[model samples]
Target: MTAHETTLCTLFAEVLGLPRVHPGQSFTGLGGDSIQAIQVVSRARLAGLVVTTREVLRSESVSALAAAARTDDRTRDRSGPVTPPRRFGPLAATPIMEWLGELDGPVDTYNQSLVVRTPAGFDAPAAERLVQALLDTHDVLRLRLPEGLAAPVPAARIPEPGTVSAAALVACVDARFATDEELPALMRGHMRAARALLSPREGTMLRAVLLDRGADRQGRLALVVHHLAVDGVSWRILQDDLRTCWAALASGAAPAPDPVHTPFAHWADLLRAEATSGRRMAEAARWDDVLRPAPAPLAGVRAPGPLDPETARNTHVLTLPPEFTGPLLTAAPGLVNGTVNDVLLTGLALAVLNWRRDGDGDGPPGTDPAGGRVLVDVEGHGREDVVDGLDLSRTVGWFTTVYPVRLDLGPTDPADARAAGPALGAALRRVKEDLRAVPDKGIGFGLLRHLNSHTGPGLARRGIPEIGFNYLGRFPMGDDRAWSAAPGHAFALDDADEGLPMAHAVEVNAAAHEGPDGLTLNATWTWAGNAYPGTRVRALAEEWFAMLRALARYTAKPGAAALTPSDVSLADISQADLDSFESQLGELL
Candidate 1:
């Protein structure tokens, strides 16, 4: 192999945890995902090779990527650690501003948590030191919310870590669990106590629960952090940092994890400017159309009520088998010139339309999902490269954006598996095009609706979708021995108050994981129980999975996948015109 190819293979093996990677081995085929791809690109840049996330996915193979990779100094610092600004101040680009305005809802539930195992001999003092280092390293972990949103200086800020106490930042508790079955209930109890322990206004946003088994057995550690300071990507960063800090502390060296690529506070300031930019203001009208109320009431929905944790919230889990998931994540995307999200959502749109059509007509008094349109609020990572010289690959915070999307896949055939092939293809094309039309991956929507002074009021007055969709990107399972996800302990979220209102009637959170079997996509459907029957929701979930299965089978055929007009940025052309152009070009060749 050439020099670049050698470097690419080494990076691939390290990131994917393989003994070695051959030139012809595909990236996705080897279980690499967009999340891992970012790490590869970052490492490659440090080695004087410029390879982007897109290139890693598109070029798949080590040799192919090496040939396409170029030498550049522009991105050398793209993944390096970033230091805090000299002066800590308020951040205006707060995406949670709208949520903060709801005074009655419980703020404690708005948090994410993870449970992992600590190395042998890991105890209280080491864990405490690790927490202090983490708070000092990531500025967002030290964020403070004002007592009231109406306060004069209500914007959140990251105070210098020197003045903060690690013990105060996160409440710590140590307990013992004798067996695996006892772990779940014990973790649940700790999570409930966290509701009282975690307070954004008090700058107490984390709760660390240490689970001890026998001294011979490895112990478990749970870190529950408020959503304001973390997101899905941020967890991976924390895991890496924790491992680094643990090793350093074990060796009697001060643990110094990677620096922040761009501080969350800095990004907040940039978003404040971007929200009121002339370009964003021009998008006000387009957003107005997207947020327009649905023509008909959603199927199986009763009069909506507040998002209650105890009575209203219900969950149904759905999965696509590993056999189908492997292709869906790798080959299926290449077929349609899209990403896994596009294909997965295409299945969802088809299932929703079909389920509504086949319903007992017992839907609330109007046409179910009128005119074959399904309105959904989609969640994004919100870390777009909108601002030059700003990289958020390592930054942590609740940098998430929620925007509405209308999946308009005109009428299709009823639910007949044999004849669903044509409908699947058409739906894929329509949904892919719809997502492509989202401006800046839907980042500006939150800004205009909540942050912009001129457009905020008008956008806020518009209706929100009844359904929400969030696809947490695919990730590899626990491979690191030093600090990996706890085995047989599933509890991860802090318990929310029962009286808080939900944002949507139903919210779908989907993620794919590589397991011993292969890759599997798991989706959890959470809905307000009072508004929708559990039986009906389960039926809908089954329909969604069936649609995904059909999509996977259809794409397995020869010549099933082809580029659509929206896949090209050259000019606006209908699918028919593009198909004709491809046919002619093929004939000439």
Candidate 2:
């Protein structure tokens, strides 16, 4: 490798924590996933270099990446020390802290969307007004952070309504919404094209889109923000604020109250100040304990070959009935004094354990029925409890963390499934308490793990956890009347993709949907390609329903006897039997 290439390779090796990176080794071949890709991009960007993950994946050589990085104008200008933007306190949340904590790098994978729907009497002028209102509301939307600790300069004016690209408009919606097949391909296509228009120097980390389907009759306004700039909560805030702004514009009124809180830069400043004050290091050490690296690598079975490109993927959503959900909500106050999230997490853990055990033919190999341990990676909501009066319902920041919780299932009694609920609940409560005590609430710890390149084949294995749980808050649904007014809006919003896949790798998401009746638990799972087949997933869902029913019965009636696996003859229930059970349950509910 040339001297420059050698220098770059050394930096990569150090930053990535790889023992040694060969000049010709592919990043993906080295097992680089989305998380790692982000790390590489962030680090490279910080070092004044521009290199795409795809290039690194394809080149498979540090020397080539170095050459590309050097020639690329994006990385060459480290002219001066990067200065951070001004800190806005009340508005400043922890999401900005995490982004600033990222070792300067370009973002590789981007999860972007545009929520488009026709508003009543919405037109091009109104759309432009809404865009301007968005710019006026959130400081980050119009501020550009070039370096560290400096005032954020205003971003360029929003493009004209008609001039806005189609793809840009589509990106404002969530991935689940945008994945609909009926939507015009142009919507998706234009989004990708608009994303390409982003200047690496803009450090946008996110973008926006506006769509005017037609004059006054149909129009859609979307903000295609990058994952880096905000988190789920932040998006909700933006959506709510945008609606408020649009309403004002629709009525020929001025935008509502100005945001007075600290900006993200303030959080970044706090992180820096804390890092230097030794608080960050102490916090890091505390995380080291909570996130103690696993002794054994995660177990991952090698794929026989490439995943089937033609494999059909479909998502089915299950909502807990009132009878089942009501008690949990009532008991939530006493159980760990937790929110609905804790209850859902406990249920999910139990579901996973049951699913894993049920999947083993007779029993898991090489272990007694009771000795098998199941590891689950629970996705955290990542908001710091210390943030005074923080309105998670509105603030924006990618404040999510992932923590692995291990459950010893060896002694778990399949015969007494009702008994498992309390144990599962206890484990979740313990994890929650342990996490809350951490200085940074596991955010810094999570970032370090990702940055340090700790999870991989050699450093870590994958199969330790039979399942993953992510509880996203209430899904957003724009005003139906407003949505219908948009012309050419054909996409249907559903919770089909909310479940974990049937494969070995499963992620169960319990999304809350605000309905006339109250909160509905829209649960879905995404399974790994190999680990879960359709039959197995369907069975697990049925089993979960049965378990929930038993728990509800036991909880409601003190003298009721707990049901056993034998009592229900669950093993004998075929796919058809499960389907019938589900149908009956639906009818009864």
User: What C-alpha lDDT do the candidate models reach, one value each?
Assistant: 0.72, 0.45
Q: Which prediction has the highest lDDT against the true structure?
A: 1
Under the 3 Å rule for N, CA and C atoms, how many clashes does model 2 have? 67
Model 1, residue pairs in steric clash: 81-259, 82-259, 82-260, 307-501, 307-502
TM-score of 1: 0.87
| Candidate 1 structure quality by residue, lDDT tens digits, 1-589 | 9999999999998877678999998676666766677678766765778776767866857889999998956545667676554336675537665544542576654678788877756777777788888888888787777663444443566688765677654444445435656775776687667655777777776778766654566666788888778877777778878887898988999987766657787788888888889888888998988877665545222233465443433888778898788777667766766777788777777767766766534464223546667777888777776876565666778787888788887765635432446667767777888988898888888888888878877877776676778888765564436577775544333244556566777778888876566678988887776556777778778888888878778767755777788777769688767767877877898
RMSD of 1: 4.1
Q: Candidate 1 at 184: error in angstroms?
A: 4.1
